[model samples]
Target chain A: MTNETGAPLLDVSGVTLRYKTPGALITATERVSFAVNRSDRFVLLGPSGCGKSTLLKAVGGYLKPSEGSITILGRKVMEPGPDRMMVFQEFDQLLPWKTVLENVMFPLLDARNLSRKEAEEKARHYIDKVSLTRALHSYPHTLSGGMKQRVAIARGMAMEPDILLMDEPFAALDALTRRTCQDELLQLWEETRFTVMFVTHSINEAIKIGNRILLLSPHPGRVKAEVVDVDTASPTDGSAGQLEKEIHDMLFSQEEAH
Target chain B: MSSKARIVMRPLEDAGSGEVERELSFLEKAWDNSGVRKVAIILALALIWELYGRWTDNALLFPPLSDTFAALIDNIRSGVLPARAWTSLKILLMGYAAGIVMAGILTIAAINTRLGSDFLETMTAMLSPLPAIALLPLALLWFGLGNGSLVFILIHSVLWPVALNTHSGFRAVSTTLRMVGRNYGLKGFAFIRKILIPAAFPSILAGLKIGWAFAWRTLVAAELVFGVSSGQGGLGWFIFENRNLLEIPSVFAGLLTVILIGLIVENLIFRTIERRTVLRWGLQS
Candidate 1:
């Protein structure tokens, strides 16, 4: 792995993650490495079983890497903290017992150790950013799938963490909602420019969401290539299709070789 | 053949003529109220009982529903039924609360460690199926002729079900929710208090209901076997005394009191708690 420019905000070097099943020791990722600079939308794009989610979890400090290390601000990642908040794919990530306002304020009031008043104000700001002011008192179960994900995103964003790790946040949403959420996410990013590490299987989403897309191979995922789309072109432009086709051809040719 | 048959499709423009919602008849509306439906069933049952009692025509045998009610009123007026009910309710509360506290301790410990988990599983397996009343004879030998023995059996009946349901509920909390909780740096007690407890509250409430039922029945049954404890007795003893004195209507009245208490506790107290918590949260419909 190459260290680009000055100090990267987050550095994951040769990280190898493994877990034990009842009968087997499974390797999820093999020496997969990348660095996410501050304000970069870094997307880990791969197919199912490619260990992108596992890698994200590793960065979030929920899972430990067996062989290598993950660091943010030169501090070794050991366990989950407010420093790296995760927006999960499932709606159950928001506590059902808590209202939307409370859910967003949870980590703010907790790990951030903010005053209740400060937390509520910050929570409200983020919730409003997600356009969920109307649902401040609603429970997760009462909200639609998209709304739940938005609350999750708001909760993660409210913490103002070093990096926000999103594990296919919009993957469970309906297509129309997914598109809308992605646009909203980009708009939010444009407004704040907070660093985010997004994991997704959708290539179109990868291109649309990431400034730097890291393609991973199928199983025991190893980084195949890091495609830097310096143009900042979205799918609305014809160049996105060109880049998509190029990435597809590269993946297809690699599969043919295998 | 393809050219001859073209597909004809029509979109649903106004599917229900803009009147999808309609008003129901008065009877239909009444049928929708569970309380009304239950009352209707009760009236039908009372009519059957009155007819059957009249056919038998033996006051010594099955007393009429009206006679039973009259007997119940008579006992209440004499302050006999109220005193007995109070006696039973006091003992029931002591036993039920103690049992709940023990269950909570056990469940919290079980979720925290392997040994505690094993202890809970083994205890529930061994004790839950063995009827609590079956322990009364042994309890009497140990505690001897007092409320102590009855409380002992009540604890036995209530502890297992509450612990079992709570353990399972905690275990059944979704992995995603657990991660979300931990991701906020909530560890150990905070994790259990904020995440696990409320997440598994539906099962906890069910366990409470089951424990209440078990403790109530065991209390009554124990009273029947050893009703005289330290010179006072409960409703079960009231029934036993009336039966011995050939007061059949009074015995029925005692039985009616038990049913009434059970109905009120279940429909009022537990129902209110459920509505305020799990039902309000939509965890249980």
Candidate 2:
């Protein structure tokens, strides 16, 4: 699949993101470059301060890179658009006032220009995909944390964007629920083969979810290495453990050196 | 898996294992009901007021609860108190509606632009602390002693709290929610209507409640002065007139009517809105 790629679906090149704090100009990521092909389950794996989430935000067009460019399907992303839908880590990402169905349907009606009936039909399809059909009328607050995340996923998938951007999507869930959610996400990907740029600090999650994983270094995040053929590293097997240990050593060895 | 010693276990009791449904005692049931508790409190307060009035035995200063009730019933029958209350309510509604509309515009402005936000902050800081009643003399001079003057002061009282609360509410909206709204390409008024308004509704409802209380009291106070000059006013005028005539029971009745109106608005109007929107949406308790 890597050799078969043609001009990669989304190209992010040498992007640097910085923001001004009270007293200092903090760099979130510096000169990070990567390409996500069509239907690629691309994962950004790093420590908490590595700014993988910031890169995802830049890709989502919520933040502009201080240098370099991010282009989706040959167009530079200048601002947030419906082409890239994001499933946020925070449970409050789903509109509290909207029921599960409405939350999913909102972007469709708002940006996709679909008729109300069409939006509802499309929304219900995605909602059912997430196995939240029974909770179609329930508000976000009424749902459990895992259920809320599912609803958020449903809302994002309903948009059917060029690429889905996820920022530590299941990071807030309980351990058991998190595993189930990760499995569900993989199952959904298997069915649809939708391109996703998933950001996570968990090694297991990165290996399990991404076919290609980009390892990043801590603070002022820079691309450390890129690991390919991750889809072959099954989590239950010895190779997955070996891969996990390799990624961990690469991430923490710099800290020891410093 | 067989052990050396055999253990005997009792079968689980199905009846006791499930949830138990037991009827509450009559007094316990009554106390548990909110409406019943509220009514009980009101009755207890009425009893205390009656006892105190009787103990004092000064009808001119403090009419007994029973005498006040009689006067209230008499005025209702005569259509005097009803007319006065209706007049006050009409002016109050006008002012409240105008104030809310203006506050909405100001809040939208504050959310959209830096200058508008600064303007709102400055205006609220400068004007919110100034009592609406204090503006009555200027209002009287500008709008004359009528409904116009009364509404002017009412707007003054209602506008600031509503604007300030709404602005704060908008500012407090979660970053994630804002990003979601922007991700959908929602801009300006549509953004406010869809994301900001519902997200900020609980605080906005609080603002509405504060604004209502301020507007109600300001109207009454403004009417007191307005009645003296205009020769026609609302509930405040009714109370002042009765006081002049030395009809202490009627004066107490007028004051009771003011409290009744306040209770009706707070419980009926605002509570219904809160229940339908904020509470139902789980934005507030």
Candidate 3:
């Protein structure tokens, strides 16, 4: 995929991920190719164990693919760096000891050439962006699941990474909270225009948040389908119900077939 | 309206105000009070002990709380207690500080190297069960009748618990947290500081508490066993001396001081720390 405005933010080509456990070498994903444009909300949707999260991890540079390569803004990802930050499913992703503000400020402290004051300012900006200004001094234990994820998101965004990787970050949240967070994420993206690669099993979430959704098959996940959201300019409106239902049906039938 | 219907209606009309009044009365009566029960239990235990002490009439074997407190007051007034306490505390601090520093370095080294970690695990496995008091005689032989001997035993008592706790805490930090730290480009000491240390804090705090208790107990016992007084002996030495002289109440006094100190350190210092850090954070079970 070629973009006219700017070069693609993330280009993942023929990526294959594998894991070796006690007995056998398990193939997680195969021949996966995708390009996320600058500020594109790219979503990977699949069944459990279909390597959606693995793909996200690979992009975040936590997992080196068994084969092929991933590049962010023409720079190849070799190892985990400050270029890409990830929001994880587990609320415990935030360091329990650090307050909400501290957790947000964490990435900036390690990033190059930022003083404590500067980091604090940057962290505060992102924390406010995530609407967690009220909970700044409160520890992770005091925050609810949604609040914790917001802190994680704030922390990830504070780094100003080239791409934000989310591995089912809202999967643990309740329905009402999940929708609210999804809306907030879209708002943040609209404002900041940071690239995102999101993984989720929920079709509704994929359709609602993703600019482009890529579906993967189970058992060594291969790209089954890609749906472009040209018709819906805005992701979250009451009218997207039809689109959500259609995608839901597609995923359900796909699962039934397998 | 029928008579029976009128009776039912009248009762229902009264029920609302009566229910509220009953609820208020129940609240006033303290329907679910545990404070009284707790006080009662403590008083009952004290009464039993007093009765038992009266029956035995043995001042040496089982001194009453009153007798112990009186002796404690006398010793404190005479100034033998304060001077000896200071000496013991100094030794305790020195040994405890040394042990903590050593354990921290070892843990850092261990975390970085597989071989170091394996070695630590093996050594801890071998040495954890060997009592600190049991090392007193050996410590005496090595350091020869001074604070050095007491220091050695205190170090032995402190090292294992602290090392074990720290190492395990470092190990138990979530992999996701580590990955997140690395994702932000933190490595080596930065990673351990920002990610591992905080994540493992509850465990580390537990270790510190245990190590402190061990060190405190070991220091006194070591002193008692090897009391070579250059005009100063710790609480344990004081007790031993008092016992030898057949000053039974003073012996009881020394023992009481030890208990008091332990209670103060544990409840007043360490308990507050646990409450503020681990319990407040909801990290500890």
User: Considering every candidate listed, which one attains the maximal TM-score?
Assistant: 1
DockQ of each: 0.74, 0.73, 0.63
lDDT of 2 by residue, A140-239 (tens): 8899999999998888888999999999999999999999999999999999999999999999999999999999997889999999989999767699
Report the C-alpha lDDT of model 3 over B220-269, residue by residue, as the tens digit: 88778877456688888988888898877788788768877888888889
TM-score of 1: 0.94
For the predicted complex of model 1, DockQ is: 0.74
Which CAPRI tier for candidate 1?
medium
DockQ of structure 2:
0.73
Per-residue lDDT of candidate 1, residues A158-234 (tens digit): 99988999999999999999999999999999999999999999888999899999999877899999999634665
- Please, what are the lDDT tens digits per residue for candidate 1 over residues B186-282? 9999999999999999999999999999999999999998887888899999999999999999999999999999999999999999988888677
- How many residue pairs in model 1 have overlapping backbones? 0
The CAPRI-style docking tier of model 3 reads medium
lDDT by residue (A84-124, candidate 3, tens digit) is 88899998888776788877776687675589999999999
Candidate 3: list runs displaced more than 4 Å.
A1-6, A230-258, B1-63, B229-231
lDDT: worst 10-residue window of model 3 chain B = B2-11
lDDT of 2 by residue, B1-285 (tens): 876897888777845757688789999999999999999999999999999999999999898999999999999999999989988888899999999999999988887789999999999999999999999889889998678888888998999999999999999999999999998988888889999999999999999999999998888887776584445469988988999999999999999999999999889999999988888788887
- Global lDDT of each model? 0.92, 0.91, 0.84
- Return the lDDT, model 1, position B1: 46
